[model samples]
Target: MQGFKKAFAEQLRLALPSQEVTLERPKDYQKGDLAFPCFKASQSLGMSPQSLASLLASKIKIKDATIEATGPYVNLRLLESVRSRETLASTLGNYPLPPQEKKNATILVEYSSPNIAKLFTIGHVRSTMLGHALANIYAQEGYEVVRLNHLGDWGTQFGTLLAAYELWAKDSNPELEKNFPWAAEYSSESTTPLHRLLQLYIRFHAEEEKNVSLREDARAWFKKLENQDPDARRLWKKFRDLSLIEFNRIYERLGVTFDSLEYGEAFYEDQIPGVLNALDSKGLLKEGENGSKVVDLSEEGFDIPCLIQKGDGTSIYASRDLAAALFRKSKWNYERCLYVAGSEQNFHFQQVFAILSKIDPWFKNKQTHVPFGLIKLPEGKMSTRKGNVIFLEDVLNEARDRIQKIISAKNPELSNQAATSEMLGTGAVIFINAFNDRNTSITFDWNKVLAFEGDTGPYVQYAHARICSIFRRAGGSWSQWAEPRSEDFGRLHFESIELPKSLQGLDHASAQHLIFELNGLEPALKASAISLSPTSLARQLLTISKAFSVFYNDSPILNVEQSEAIRQSRLLLCLATARVINQGLRWLGIFAPTEM
Candidate 1:
């Protein structure tokens, strides 16, 4: 397909020597496989679009394609035989897909920065998955990706948790038994540590409403923690350790990893002083309301000043972020650093980037804030302070449980049911999260997320599995047949596929459509990477799956009555489709099961 596209582009260039040529696909596939709009060329050539299109159509000639003028567009359609040959060669050949050249660059992707001692809630899913997918996408396109967690370990929230723990949870006290009875029951369990910490956090906020002094107490505890008070440091470290233990379990299930887990907000505590000194030296630091140290953004068109430190002399998130950015730049020298976070913090990032621009003007272009919308339950938005949140682990577990039941009933004899069900379940969750544009808010629904049909993860996974089943029934594995040139592989080889006469009906149409759809994978990957959105790639996978499904129903790859050449050709097509679905799913951090 790449060769075909390049050849056509070259022909169009030769045809319209005076005009720059760029080809695009028509909105309607029936119009053509590729199109060139003549509006710009017509204007430049002092002719009407229709006249230019018709004139160019007459001049351009392709070896295995037809060129014609449709209204103001010059359209070209490759013959079915040409389409199949080129597409299969591209998809199955040694150098396949992701036609993007080597970037020779590094991308630093920071995501899944769940606060230390907080639950990995569904609210965190959008950033976590979006960042993970972006990292995978960048890596696939040949960028050195550095995955960062950027844990939220140093904040007033931690102060509140510390105060609550000291007040009622550090020991078996009457307050703990009276206020949170279930905490004692779960105290001895391995998972109870983080859960109990969450309860303490929630209790602090709930109690603060009745006790005004609790807020001040929390601030004081945070101040102590900043000053490296031994007790405060010990408690914070204990809570941070427990929270990470719980988080890693979920990350394992989700199949996400980071290059550096040691770098959190707290890790930059010592560097904050240097950041403040630099700001002060540059006259960017100012005394704001309540004696807080700030950077006035009045000239930057921002009404609100960026707070660098609190009135109590403790550093704030902005200051820590400044330090983190500097540390990242000094350490990784990344070509681009992407911060994947929620939309609510758009202003915060703007201010941070603005301040960085003043300090290191070159950095403004290197950093990007990839903001995404929040995930909401049917009732309303989730809140960690109110304990009105759904944990990510719970959602994943529920998906696994529900999918397992369906698999149990549908395929009773299926081996590896447990692993397969888990894969399908998690893949379902991940796919739905990525199915839409990153900035669009999603209302989580059980039915939609777990759906097995119609543009869903399971639908695509099933397509791959069905193809694998075809090879199984043919007494060979897909890996053996799909890549027969491997040293030990021998089943299918690159050969001319003469379709049986019967395939010329609906089967032929669907087969050509499938081949064309597969050709779009490279373009889709490029679009997804450009927009930093996984939605484009997700839609492409679904499109490819649907096309394959039509071909699967319309054609039979193993019918004994058919010629072996026809069967082999169809099987080769199926192999290409399966490989694509497998790679696409894996890139999006979803598993492509050989059996489902």
Candidate 2:
């Protein structure tokens, strides 16, 4: 289908050598599959749009398509047989996508930097999934992508946790130790070291209200950690290691991974001195209040300076970020580095990028902050210190439990019910996160995310499953077309069988609309990458699902009254729709189940 569009565009260009041709699909498919508006050309030619359209229509000719002039547009309608064959072949992976210019370049994406002692909350899902989707999209466009997780394993938050641990050790407070034991072993049990650290953290905050000296103690502990105190370093390493064990369990379920696990803030802590020395040598470093080092951005139109260090001689976020940026450029030489953080940190990124630009102008155009809006529950905001948070694992477990009950009621004897329920459950959560624009704040709703109908992940997955069921009812080797050997159901292989020659069964309006929607996958992917948003691709998948529903209702693929050739052709169309939906969902990091 993409090849056909390119051919049509070339034919139009040859007809109007003086103008750049622009093509669009009409709102109503009855007009044409592709339309060329002549308003701009007509103005330059000193003629009416209708007249110019007619002139171009008469001059242009495509091999398997009909060209017509309808008012100010030149519409091209593809021959039904040729359109069916081309569309099916494209969706079945017989056609190759056009070449990409960035095939030789690399992209670095950093995201999901949750703090060490906190649980993975619903608020962190936006950045994690959005960054994952964008990285997938970039790889699809032929760029070498490097996934990074700039962990929040440093700073005063760790100080508070360390202080709390020392203040309430197992020997000092037996009551607190009973609730959360400070054991050396870490496992998948409920009382892991991470959970104990979180409880200790919350208790410290709660007790700080009555004890005014706890804040000072935390600050002092952090200063010790910065000065290479052996005890402080040992505890920090323990917390960091155990946190990764807990975080990786969630990442495993979500099917996410990073290229470099060691390139976090702590990894660049020792490099901070080099950054400060370089800035001081360049005369860019300034002395701010309280002996802290800073960079004045008054000429850059900012009221406040970028703090490079604290008054206590500890390196801060700006200094560490500068070092990370410099290391990425020297190490990976990425063409673009994307930081997927929340919108609230926009100013902090701006300050870091400004400093990079002043130090080296080449860094000006290479970095981007892919900011997303917040996600909240109906009760308002969540806070880690107050212990009013929802863990991601709990939400996923709840979704899986609900799906398991629904499957037991709907398909009592279905095989692999446990695995299918998990797939559908996790896919539902991922789809809802990707369905909206990146910057649109969402109040999480369970009904919308889990609905089997409407614009939901289950709706699209069910469409693929229905197609599989069709093949199952047909019996014999039909199941092999779905790639039964692979764990991923979307790894379809339908090209082994030849499509029926009598494709006149697909001439119906509904079938044509479905084919038209299938043709849009490539363009939709391009648009999603360009805008850095998955909403376009998600909506396109929903449109394909709706179109398939219409086609399924109006046409019969296996009725005895229909001829064998027509049934085979209709079945081929069904397979094509399933394959396209599966591919789109895979790119968004969602799975398409062959059964629901």
Candidate 3:
């Protein structure tokens, strides 16, 4: 299909000298397979579109290909033999191999940034999975992508944590002596321990609420930490170290890796000054009530002002974000920068981008915010503080366990339990999320997620495995016969082959339909990248798989009384279908197992 589109596009370039023609699938398959609007061509030639289309229809002659005019649309029907050869070749060829001219574009994808002293929540999984998939897609497109796990390693939350740690220091269990072990233990502890810490934080806030002097003290402590005060700095490092240990374990389980690690706190010390200067230089900084510095985006309809600096001269989230953006732009020099964050933070990113654009207009178009919807629990929204969130690790383990049970039931003799567990478990979870619309809230349902049938990842993997089984049954090297070809094999006949009535004829009509569908891959991939919607690609894979399924059920490669040439051709088609499925699945971070 892609080849046909390219061929048509080149043909149009030569035929329509003064007008641009777009090759597109016809609105209805009956109107001919592919269509080119002749409105522009007609205008260029000072004739009616229908007349111009009719003229071109007579000139273009393709083998077994038909051309027709439908009003202003010039429709082309692909030869069945040509499509069969093309689809077979595409299925056999290594698709989406590294492009020759690899773009030296650096992209910093900041995602899965779970906070320190926090467990991995389902919401965290959404960002982690989505970001990793996007990174994979970008890499396939030949971009140098840097996956950054921007851990929430620093914040005022640490101040509260420090206060909590000090108060609960003595009650620490030796078994829980590891860093941030208290995070988990604290969840089960009496409210006494956490309540005390919360009270201290609240007390500090209340004291500073009216007394500017007390607020200055908290700022002084935070500044001391930023300035590398021994005690404050040591405590901050301990929290960061402990949190990373937990985060890395989760990342490994999820099969995600980062090229760089940047602390939100690290930016605070040095990046804040630069950001403040840039804001001041642009004359965008404004003094707000209560002695805070802010960016007023009221004109942009964002009701809440972005707090750049706190009342006590302390930098805030907006300040760190501005610094991070500048530092990233300078270091990576990325052609594109995508921020994979929750949709709830839409305003926050808008402010960040607005501030960056004000500082450097060149960066205005490069920065993008890839927002995704939330993952809610059956009861309600999950909250980390409430300890009501499902840990991503727990979800993964549960998925593995479910797959193990199914494997035990279906194939008790299977060895390599670990490998099978990983494949089924990870594949199931990824497919569940990837198949859904990115903007819709996903309710974590075990039954739906673990189902082996329907539009799940396992179903696709099963289809690939089924093809492998067929090859195994053939008892010959499938790879040896599979090769790319430009011309169609003449042996294949749609009328003789018994296929599903829906996909019966492999004549011009069916071939054209298949060709048009195949042409959508590249554009679909681009759309998936732009929208961060894996479902688009998922749907395409499903379509291809279903088409192949019909072909497999109807066409008999081994038993048919045909020449070696025809058998090899059909085998090559099967191989190409398998390759496309594997490549597409890989993009979604889903594995395609050779066997079920």
Candidate 4:
């Protein structure tokens, strides 16, 4: 469908010269397959839309394409053999390979950024899954994609934690000792123990509220740390190392990897100075209360001012982001930069882009935010502060356990292939999240995500596996079923095949449907990459699977009449369909198993 649209669009450009023609699918399959409205061209050609369509219908002849006029629209139908063969060749021959032109574009994708000392929640899954999928999609398109884990490693929260640790170390608490063994013993006889850490943190914040001096003290400590206080640096490195060890385990289970690990803290020394200089040069910086520097964007309708430097002159998030962007641009010279973040920070990105635009207009349009919706639990919204969030590792493990049980019941013989089961289980989790449009709120439903049937990831994997089973039963290699040359196989007689005509009806209809759908891949990818919507690719995979189902049930490969040409032709088509499904699933970072 995509190829036909491109060809038709080009043909129209030549035919009308002065007007633009848009290709669309007819609402009803019975009204031909692809539709083109002639309304715009009518005025330019000095004729009614209907009349213009009629004129073009008479003059234009696309090889292997049937054209008809319906009211003000021109509908087209491709010769069955052409549609089948092209779809087959593209699927089987070109998949998993990038076009020569798109091979060099380098992309930096930052996602799944969970804060240190926080449990991996469903909210974290959105960016992680979405980023991984986008990276895969870009890589498939031949881009040298750099996956960066821009971890939230630096913040005032660490100071609070440190203070909490100090207070807790003064008192010996056994429960805290058990939970946080590493930080249990830090003080002398008056030392606070680990169990009372949370209470200590709360007390510290409460006192800071009433006593301005204590607040100033904490700020002073942070500044000292920022100014290369040896103790602060040592603690920061230890905390960062501990947090990453835990984070990497979750990432490994999710089958995600990053080309680099850059901490938010890493940019503090160099980034703060550069950003301050840039803001000062632009005259965008303004002093706020408590010695903090802020960028006032109230005129831009954002009530929240971006705090570049906090009170006591400590750098904040906005400053770090600005530094990161400048560093990335100068280091990689990326044509496009994407930030996969939660939608709650939509305004934050708007401010970031606006600030960058003021500083470097060239980067204004190039920087993009792919914001996704929050992941809510059944009870309500997840809160990391309350320690009420489901860990990502827990989700993956539960999925794997459930899959293992199902495998035990259905295919016990293959239980030894633990690696494959792990892949399928993890794939399901990714697909469940990726299947939806990224901006919509996702209610994590265990039943829906883990389902082995229906439109889930495992379902598609099963479908591919089923096809492979057919190839095995046939006792021959798929290559034995060569694609029929145009001369050898003339126009297909849909009725001549063993299956009922209605069976082919779906594929016949869907071949056109898929062609149109597949045609949107490039545009869809560009949109997804820009918008950070893995859901688009998810939807694409679903459509491909749906098309394959139609092809599978309607077309018979093994039991058809024993004519060598027809059998081979059908096999080639089936192989091509399978290839498309495999490649599409891969883009979503899901695996297509060879057997269920």
Instruction: Tell me the tens digit of each residue's lDDT in model 2 across 1-596.
Output: 55667988898778777898878977677787899999998998899999999998898888888999999999988888777888886565532233245689989989998889888877788888888888888887879889999998887778898899898964546555354332222234446667777888888898898897998788788889999999999999999999999889888888887886798889898899989987898899999999999999999988999999988888888899999999998999889999999998999999999999998888988899999887767787677787666677767777888889999999989999999989888888888888888897777666765655578888889888998889889776665675423322112233445656567589888998998888777778899988888888888899999899999988998775977778888888887887778778877878888877
Better of 2 and 3 by TM-score: 2
| RMSD of candidates 1 onward, in order | 4.0, 3.4, 7.3, 7.4
Q: Pairs clashing in candidate 1?
A: none
Residue range 1-596, candidate 4, lDDT tens digits = 55777888788778888677778767565566578898878877778999988888887777888988899998887676565555444444433222435666678888887776555666787898788888876765567777877787776766665654554443544334444332233222113222244334445666666786766556665676688888777866766676677778777777677877764556455678899999999998999878989998887777978888987778777888898888888888887777889889888899988888888887868777888888888898876544455656667767888888888888988735677677788888888788778878877777876776777888778767777777767666652322222210011011111221222322456455554444344455565655566666666667666766776677666887656565666555556555556666666767667775
TM-score of model 2 vs. true structure:
0.93
Question: How do the residues 528-581 of candidate 1 rate in per-residue lDDT, one tens digit apiece?
Answer: 899999988999999999999999998888875877778777887888888788
TM-score of each: 0.93, 0.93, 0.81, 0.83
For TM-score, candidate 1 versus 3, the one ahead is 1
Q: Which ten residues in a row have the lowest lDDT in candidate 1?
A: 486-495
Off by over 4 Å in 2: 94-102, 170-174, 177-190, 209-212, 484-504
* lDDT agreement with native, every candidate: 0.82, 0.82, 0.67, 0.67
